[model samples]
Target chain A: MGAHTMEPASSSWVTLLGDSDRRGGTTAARNTAPKELLWKVTLGDSIRSSPVLAAGVVLVTCRDGHLYAFDARTGRERWSYATPASVHSTPSLSGDLVLFGCDDGAVYAVDRTSGGLRWKAQSEGAIWTSPSVHRGTAYFGTHGGVFNAVDILSGRTQWSRRFDGRIHSSAYATDDRVYFGCSDGCVYALASSTGADAWRYQTGEGVTASPAVKDGLVLVGSEDHVFYALDAGSGAVRWRFQTGLGLASSPAVTAGKVFFGGKDGHVYALAVADGREIWKSPSIRQITAAPLAGASLVCVQGFFGTTQAYDLNTGDTLWTASLGGSLGSTPVITDDTVYLATYPGVIYALR
Target chain B: MNRRTFVYNAALGTLHVGLLGTQLRAFQNTPSAPTLQIDIQAPDLPLSKLAMPGLFPGRVVQASHAGSLLNGRVQQAPVGQMLDQGMRALTGESTSKEAWAKFIEPSDIVALKVNPSGTPTTTTSIPLMREVIRALNAVGVPNRNIIVFDRNSNQMEVLGYHNLLPVGVRVVGLDGDWAIGGRTRPGYDPNVFAEMNCFGERETRSYMGSVVSEASKIINLPCLKEHNASGVTGCLKNLAYGCFNNVARTHRFPKTYTDPAIAVLCTAPPLRAKAVLHIMDGIRAVYHGGPFAWNPDFVWEAKTLLIGTDPVAVDRIELEMVEQKRRDVGAPSLWDRNPQNLGSAADMDRSAQKNRFYREPGHIKTASELGLGRWELEQIELRKLQIS
Candidate 1:
């Protein structure tokens, strides 16, 4: 059975980059990469969509056009929902539904438990980013340059706005604004209620990376090799930190520090308020996905097979282990365990 | 003049009589002025302030890294190093960033036209692309202004161009000027097009991609591959075929219009003025089965990066390297026109020594004659570097 609850009665991850503690808190303070492999399963294709966990089930999307559910403890396949094209969008759980966008230009809601299709709302172009569900609505962007806000219950489009570029960046919603990156090289703050452009800050390049909002500031990375912190209300750049390469991964904030990875092959931690460099790990190859920031440690996957975890405070390498295949997705941390997916379609459960 | 089979074939027959050499010589017989009916029309747009053969005219840099490829996979460090060295040498600048500033500006929307149709076997190396993006960033070009694009979005996605580059830099694949067959699509500019009637096709115009048309400058990143239609697929050919829509019609089986079309396309406004740099990726190249590395045996790691503002000059050097590789492999050169030497049309991989068309490797020379860049090998100052 599926349930729609944040920080449920136990430690679980409800969304991409979502996690809870043993106290049933919403903070994904996962501090370490577990040493032992619990179970590992290979999907039909590469796992670009990060895994979301709830109710002892691990949900992951694959380029094979399927949303697969596996027993978290056993790594045994429970069910899988197939789509016409690949699913690059990570799954967002709403009640009993698992919602995501697909390469076929449609957003589908599948029953989380049975992996059966609930409803499909179509867009004119391919959807490469995940749906951000807030206030009973799902928000996402499409290659057609249209960002759609659909009702979570009925999978019906409530409103849409067309931009000059595709919305490859997923949405991060605040109380009033939904922040997302656009191909036109701008980070937009759209009104959550009306889908109107509240304010936009242009970056040097497209903003494919999602915004991570905290304390009135929205943090996102641009292909311009710089990470920016913008004011949530006015979209003004408060501070910007240049990286060695372009940023693809979203920032993870914990204890006033933000951690993110760059295409330049380093894991970086900077002050969230001023965008000053606190510490940066040595070059480790290109990191494409967001690092899983727990309370004490932040974990990132190299484009290659190795996954490394560093201390959130000192940026010291805490642990390094191979996750079997080249990692194209982010590391997902749940209470007591860590999940890493690879481009070759392998999913590893380490505890 | 629209290049016709009668004129192209007759000229080749006459040229072949005196040219007991490679196919590049075939282009020499092709006069600078066309005898065929061909028309090139660019939109009434502002010409690029920075045009081809920029900074150093007739100069080319060959940067080779011994560790550019590891077990056939692209090595990032060596690729990045090679780019830095190549850019520094090409611009005679002390740093790569300073060199990039010679052509690219902070406000300019630079299009990095990539060759990605070949997919996994060979395309623009991802590592080199990253370095180019980084270099552009170093010069203060916003990631939004630096576009990594190809004609086919499908091929670009398959090659991981979107994932390979940093976020914020636009990785766009327009699919083509035409979405389905030869029909016009929004991705193509209705204003700018190359008009030529080939094979009696009703649609004679191939539009310049809307993405490239919108950009202020272009940096060509083409792969070192042979084309079944055009013998030498280099910088000019990449821009000619990669940016224009409905280009496949230029070559039907054994016939081709790539020679005049490619050279003339480069001479057209907008493209001629916007395209300022050419970097040919020869790190992993296809000596045969070009356009695509259809055969693994034909793909080799040349570990070379050809950089220059003169597309024609860089392409000429690339062709010679491919020719030399063909010689080493005991395979017929791309210029070999002996139909008897061609493998079965059904399967070229079976007989690795195969000729798809009397490949117009001479397109490089034709482009040179069209005033694109230096075509004569003796005129080009090639600076070769073996990166330790």
Candidate 2:
């Protein structure tokens, strides 16, 4: 694990919403839009998990209970692994293994190079959130509100803690603390080592959106139509911006700008400093997925089957594409390509 | 125009001009004096012989204050004062302390059953709930002994009741977090249930929550709204469905209305004996598309609270208020069976017309048949109060 951690940082997108920091690989020098469409592939079922690129291969999980690997450049199918139930969780890469949870109540670790199963661990309830690999441990939560920490190499549980509500949001981890939201209307920060409670901030409603931690604040949204910015160390509310409807879209913070979408059919951009609205683009219909910030662009998927890209700084419409099917999955952007999937099983790769 | 002619013209879609003229005339006239007493005596049974013995003897108090709401939000001070007046008027006590003491005791484990359904616009007001809690505290019930509960924890959290209530007051949800394939804890008492089959639903038995079983007494807090299945979700439906699980099966299809199901559930032993008071929040009433206030246009300011020990009697009066509001809004009667009034699948697909259910407003009368309380308006003793 230490040897792998010492490896030079590659420009690979290998996890749900891009890495444990959840910045979607945002960087100042890499901020430029992709040029045009590269390729497209049609699959068997809807894809709710965003595609993850690692080792020249793209890994995606579909509602048909199959995990597929395709060549990142040529769009050629490499292999596919079948599971017992549907997969809604995106794959997170830890060394040579790809980890993800399934609705069948099991977490699977497959070989990243070949789509072969390494080991599987059963959970008490449906595992809907994607797993985050930190150090040698894989952390995930279940619909039964139980958060589990497991050894990534052996597929053995290390420890688990149960809360009072469902855990629909994925866990975001730093070196010391882990942050996640629960259906019980609380955002909890726990010790990454022992899963002990660090602190918890109560919100006005259930929080299905995952938290994005940057600087000294943790940002998340709730079903009560409020977006909260909390002090990361003490769990104190710094500021809040209320929308017309509840927000299920996890926020993407890049260049001090926060981008998310609301069920009220609006996409919003806000300043991270004071939670003030920078600009809002309305009339997009419901957006249930997280926004992706990369390549100087902010992209959001609408539940009504459209994906819109806006300029990261100006909130202007960069481009729009109608996939002709409902979309609830976040898009993945590489150095020169954008990969998105529709609920009707179509994956589009645009450059 | 007279009432009969007006209703007939409304059904024919020709009452717009007449309704506007009537509204103008009503606005021109001085407000009528409040009626001190409305005597409604049931011929079959005497007031002393009722299902809930010694509970108002079929009497209910309707207390209203125009100042109850300001800027669409409940005024906390006015709500507290309004509750005090309503409690005194309902129990005929001279002081609020004396009135609250009549039903609550220091040793009692009092549970406040709240309805948190519907849109955020029309749930039980937090101000009203805080006032209820204050009254309970005034009567000597400890904060720890008072429990505020609903069926769905997700909905309860959305309302932030835990943060809104005083410290030590416990909030519980019967269904836990995720309802689908979620494990049922001891929160529900499997020993007690309301058994019935509606449309061959597999989960025929509705289990009662353990909170209701353990409570010494319950204060039912329900909102005023039009229900898609039971016509009006008032005191009876709130207790009947809110306290039990697997109740969604009671009204699956339009034809299988929640008539006897609601009455049966309310009359179950776990709920019938423990629930002692009914407080209906009418500050923001939904005349249609309710039980879920999805549309804001259907909501109106009622600025009133109905308090009583007799659930049936209170609901009977509540039904009238909702029907009257519907009439004022030019919507058809709750009992209308016309295809246009009942709505079709296409209409249900639309947002504005989704409230059109083959409504079972007769559930109130069905509960009356089960000896719950008085259903007929004529058999109720209503005392109307205008709070300053």
Best by DockQ: 2
Question: Model 1 off-target regions past 4 Å?
Answer: A1-10, A19-33, A324-328, B1-220, B223-313, B316-376, B379-388
lDDT of 1 by residue, B285-386 (tens): 888777766566788878999999889888888888888988898988777878777554546655557765767777787776656788888999999999
Q: Roughly what TM-score does model 1 have, to 2 decimal places?
A: 0.57
Tens-digit lDDT track for model 1 on A1-351? 137354453346666666211111234455555778899998776677788788889888987788899998899999988887667888878788988898778999998878888899998566878788887888888876888989888988999988876677888875677889986778998888889889988886667777788778888898667899899888888889988666777777778888888866788988877888989998765676778776678787776578887877898888888765343466666666777788778899988
Q: State TM-scores per candidate.
A: 0.57, 0.59
Worst 10 residues of 2 chain B by lDDT: B34-43
DockQ (0 to 1) for model 2:
0.07
Whole-structure CA lDDT of model 2: 0.74
DockQ, all candidates in order: 0.04, 0.07
